[model samples]
Structures are given as structure tokens and as C-alpha cells.
Target: MKSEPEYTPFELMAVAGARELKDGEIVAVGLGLPVVATFLAKRTHAPHITILFELGVVDPEPIHTGVGLADPRVWYRAKILSSFVDMLGMVLHRGLVDVGFLGGLETDAYGNLNTTLLGDPKGKFRHFVGSGGANDIASSARRTIIIIRHEARKLNEAVSFVTSPGYLRGYGERASAGLQGGPSRVITDKAVFGFDPESKRMRLESIHPGNTVEDVLANLSFQPIVPDAVSTTEPPTAEQVRLIREEIDPERVYAG
Candidate 1:
């Protein structure tokens, strides 16, 4: 019997991210791995997925991954190229977005993401680009999907600042604050997490192949609810590996 194709963690991550999106869903995608994942989905199972770039490029059939969100390469064959207002105000805030893809420097148990700072916000701290369109996307998109590296520092008990609201404190908190959508899934290189319906606390959904639940817990500072039986993340098919390497991200811009 022919053995299954070997795949890297990043390839597995891309496939995992692609699986979260459903066909015909409208996604507001961020940069890097999120872009690669979205493109992979569009090329494969979710061909009709509508992609919206924060900079106002809509449904772009990018020939290759762009250097940045503004790069012209990402806008190739775009159905609409407009301004931030059109994309964020007209489309996103209007509740047209089905899913929002995001990445961050830190995320807490409640799914609150912090892309703004590293240290104390009130005192000395390392500052990062606070939020481009992440806030709007997180708030209004029907549901949000976070893609980030699995590291102890990135997963915290509480982020330094709440750049993008998840559940705020917990369940019903978002509704009380008049927030719309909340975080649904978080995809990492080692595992997949989903929030509990009652407490809104993060819980382990699956562990990637070759990684155990212990491997995942060792990297997290806070405890995530682990079920008695956790599913293994399905590895990317040989075709998915080929599509990622040959068609989607040939230059290794994002997937690499």
C-alpha cells in the first residue's frame, strides 16, 4: 500500500483552517496564514466563498499571495475594488460577513484577542498596530475564526488589552454590551479550540496528528476544558498538499 504523503504542521494548519469555512460563506480574511487558508478553501471545497480584504478588495482571485494587504497581486481579478468605508461600513457593519479571520499577539480564555501591546497598557509596553479592521470584523461578522501560533505567551489568562472582543467576560456578556458575533473557533498548529456554550470558556476540540493533549496543555498557561475523548485533527490529503504547494501558495509567501 502507498503510504500517505507526509505533511508539515503549517500544511496541517492550512487544511484545518480551510475546514472551518463552509461553501458560500462570506469571509473577511486577514494577512499571512489566514490568506493561504482562505485561498485553499476557495480552490477546493468552498469554491463559492466570498473573500473580502480589509482594504476593500472583494472576491479577488489572487494569482499569488501578496506581500501585504495592499499589494496589487492580491487584487487580481477582484470583483470590486473600493475603499475601507465600502468594505467595513457598507458590507461588514451591515452584517453581510459570515465569517471573520483574524490573528493576534495574544488571546485569553474568553477568546479576547490583543494585537495592540505586549506589556502593561498603562505603563511601559511594546506597541503593535492596534487594530486595522480586526475590531469591526470581530464585532459584526456572524462568527470569527482566529488563526495563530500555539505558544504559552500568546495564550494568556487575560490579554493586556481587548483589541477585539470575544465573549468579553463570558456568556451573555457580549449581548449585554450590544456586541454581535463572537468567536467560534481558534485554529493553531498543534490543536483546535472551541468556546463552551455556557461559560464561553475555551475548550480543546481536537489535537493535530502526532500531538497529544498533553503537548497542547503544556503550551497553554490557562487550563482549557479537555473532553474525555478528543478527536485527532485530520491531516491534509495528498491533493491538499499538492494544491497548497503547487497552486495556492507556490511562492511560499504564506504557507511556507
Candidate 2:
């Protein structure tokens, strides 16, 4: 146990993020950590995986984060350079995307995300940013995966605002209203969470090493139900972390 590995915050979360992609799956990585995980996967495991960026770049042979789809780096060896609308509406909305990876400013216990307005009615943001294509991706993605560095406030009961929708109330109630593409898996700094099939609420499945249920629950927005017997989240092997932090991002990206 002592000689196993020691992972940094991002590295740990990145590992959890990477596992969300299977051996072969098309993942629509939002950017940043999600991108890091995808790149890591391309290098270490999912050689045949297709990573599509919101900016319309596909299968970019990037060693680090590009500024955006239009960034020269993205176009250098990319397979596609289409438009955002076409990608989301025509491609993504049609369920062509296998996974949609998202990073968030806040995530509710049910995995509801708030990435746009923070907390204000008049314009006060607890944590704000341009939403980009989050809305479409949330509603039409084949499946959604959320990547966030876990903390108490960020994973609170009430987000200052509603950004990307998640298990707001429940499934049937939501489906009847026509809201689609809810959270599939939520990877965080502390643990990996998934929706309970029955309750349809985000439930703790595993704990990260050096972290505990108490640690995670202590900061959650609402009380998260622990599976009768919870277990520790499997951490990345030293090799996986090194591949992402070093081999994959050899250039030390300024913006990923």
C-alpha cells in the first residue's frame, strides 16, 4: 500500500475521468480536464477511440490542449473541421456521440450542473463562465459524464444557478417533460458517483484513497446516500498518472 502511488488532485480526478471512456468509444470531451483524460486514453488505452471537441474538431492528434477548435494546433492533424451547430444538432443530437464529458462550477447531489450563471438573479455569479454548447450537449448527448475536482461548496445542495440540467427531480417526471441526456457518471476529486437505479439520485459508489465518505459527505450540497457498503475508488496506477501528466502533455499546455 505504501509503495502503490501518490496522485495529485488533478491527476487523481483525471484518472477517474479517463476510465469513463471504454476501450473503444466516441467521447465528446468539453475541454480542460476532460480533454486531458481523453488524450491520456488515446495514448494509454483507447487507441481507436474518437474524441470530438465542441469546436468541431475530431480525432485531433494533440499532445496538449489547443486554444479551441480554430486554434492552429487543432487543425494541424485533425480529421474534421465542421461547425458547432452541425456537430451538436446533426451529429450529437442524433445520438452519434457516445459520451459527453463535462467540467462544472457546481454539481448537485443528483449531478445537476451549474456552469453558466452562478448565484444571482440580477447577475451575481458564485462561479460563472460562458456555457458554450453545454445546453445542447446536456439534452441530446448519447450519455453525459461530468468531471469535477471535488470540494464541499462546489458539490452543494443548491447551486447558485441552474446551468446544465441533471437528475433534477427524478427520471419519469423528467422524461415526461422531455428533458433528455442526464448524468451517467460523475468523477470527482474525492470519489466516483452514479445514479441509483431506483431512487435516481446520485449515490456514492467508491471513495478515493486518502479520502473517506465523511470527507466527501462533509462538503456535499445535499445529503448523498451511501450504498449500503461503500468502497474506495480505484486510484490510477503510477503509470497512468505519469502517462497523462508527462508523456501525453509533454508540451505543458497553457490552456487545455
Candidate 3:
């Protein structure tokens, strides 16, 4: 028998994100890690999952994993290459999507995301590719999963700007804004987080393998609520590792 290949941190993160998805759910997938995780989920467990790209590709089983959301390879064997307005406006806004998978530059305890600007939006600072369709997905999807790197700077007490609403000011604020759903989970290299019931603040649900709760705490700019019995995140199984390496990302494009 062939020995199982070692996985990287990114691979671990991807697997973690993939495990959150359930069978038959329609997922609005953005670029970067979200793409890899959604694809892996479909191939492994959620075979009936409908994946929608921001660029209007729906349920495409690409010949190969392309570089980003806009790549031509993503459209392979697509069920429908619909127009942008039809995908986002009709499908997403009409509450047809089950989950939105997104990535960002920074996130807060409230799960608010900031992907548009760095530092103060008022002053001189760097600007990223503005919310292509992340804002729409986050606002309209039934729930969302955020995948991002864990660090002090990335996990802040408050994001510089709310590119995508989470709980907003907390406890019904999101709902008051006419948004249907909000962020349900955040998967990082160090841990997995879910929102508290009453407070709507992020709670450390589990620490990743080889990482401690203290390590996760140290990296966050704000104090995340910790459960009394925090568990360790399940490590990727050999099958998951194999599929990610050999089938999902043979070229190591994103999973690497």
C-alpha cells in the first residue's frame, strides 16, 4: 500500500472548510480557499452540491481546477452559464443559495468582514479588489462560512469597514437590516469558530490539531468566547488528503 502523503496547513484549512458543507446544499463560492473547499466537498461527500461562481458559472465540473473564480476551466461541463444578474439577483437574492463561502483580509468578533480597504478608509491606504459579489452572497445566502488565515492582524476586535455584514451590532442587528442570513462559522489554520446564541460574538468551538486554545487566543485581537468544553478539530482523514492532493488539486494550485 502507498503511504499517505503529508498535508500542508492550507490543505488542512481546505479540508476543514469542506467538512462544513452538507449534501444537496447550493453554495455560493468565491475565489481562493473557498473554491478549493467547495470542490473538495462535492467530490468527497456532497456530490449533489450546486456550486455557483460569482462570474455566473453554475454547477460546472471543470476539467481541472483553475486559478481563480474567473478562469475558463471552472466552466467545464457546466449546467448553466447564466447571466450575472440572473445568478446573483434571481438565485442568490431570492434565497435559493444555502451557503456562501468567502475569504477576507480581516474579521471581527461579530464576524464582520473587511476586504475592501486596509487601515482607515478615510485616509490614504491600500485598496483591494472591491467586493465583486461577496457582499451579495453574504447578505443573501442562508448562512456563510468564512475561510481565512489566523493572525493578530487578521482577527481584530473590529474590522476597519464592514464589507459584508455578519451580526452587525449583534443580536438581531443583521436581521433588522433586511439581510436573511449571516456568518455561521469561521475556519482558520488554528481553529474553528461559531457564533454565540445570545451575544452573536464569535466563540471558539474547536482548536485545530497541534494547536492550543491559548495559541488561538493569542492571535486574536479581541477576546473570543470560549466554550467550557472546547474540542480539537478532527484532522483530515487519509482519504481526504489523497483526494485533495491527487484529484482536487493535482497541480497544487490552491491546496498547496
lDDT by candidate, in order shown: 0.91, 0.75, 0.88
Q: Estimate each model's TM-score.
A: 0.97, 0.90, 0.95
Candidate 1 lDDT tens digits, 164-251: 9999988899989999779999999899999999999999999998899889999998998898999999889999999999988899
RMSD of 1: 1.0
What is the C-alpha RMSD, rounded to one decimal, of candidate 3? Answer: 1.8
The C-alpha stretches of model 3 lying farther than 4 A from their native spots are 1-5
Provide the lowest-lDDT 10-residue window in model 2. 247-256
Q: How many backbone clashes does candidate 2 have?
A: 4
Candidate 2 to truth, TM: 0.90
lDDT of 3 by residue, 40-144 (tens): 899888999999987788888776867676778878888998777988988998889999998899999999888899977898888987788989988999999
Provide the lowest-lDDT 10-residue window in model 3: 1-10
Give the number of colliding residue pairs in candidate 1: 0
What's model 1's TM-score?
Answer: 0.97
Residues 1-256, model 2: lDDT tens digits: 3688766777777777777787678788776778778877777778888888776778877644567655676556788877787677677887887778887788886677788766675765444575778867777776788988677778877666667777776656547658766788888878888988756788888888888788888767688778779888788898986786676665646212
- Regions more than 4 Å wrong, model 2: 68-70, 122-127, 251-256
Better candidate by lDDT, 1 or 2: 1
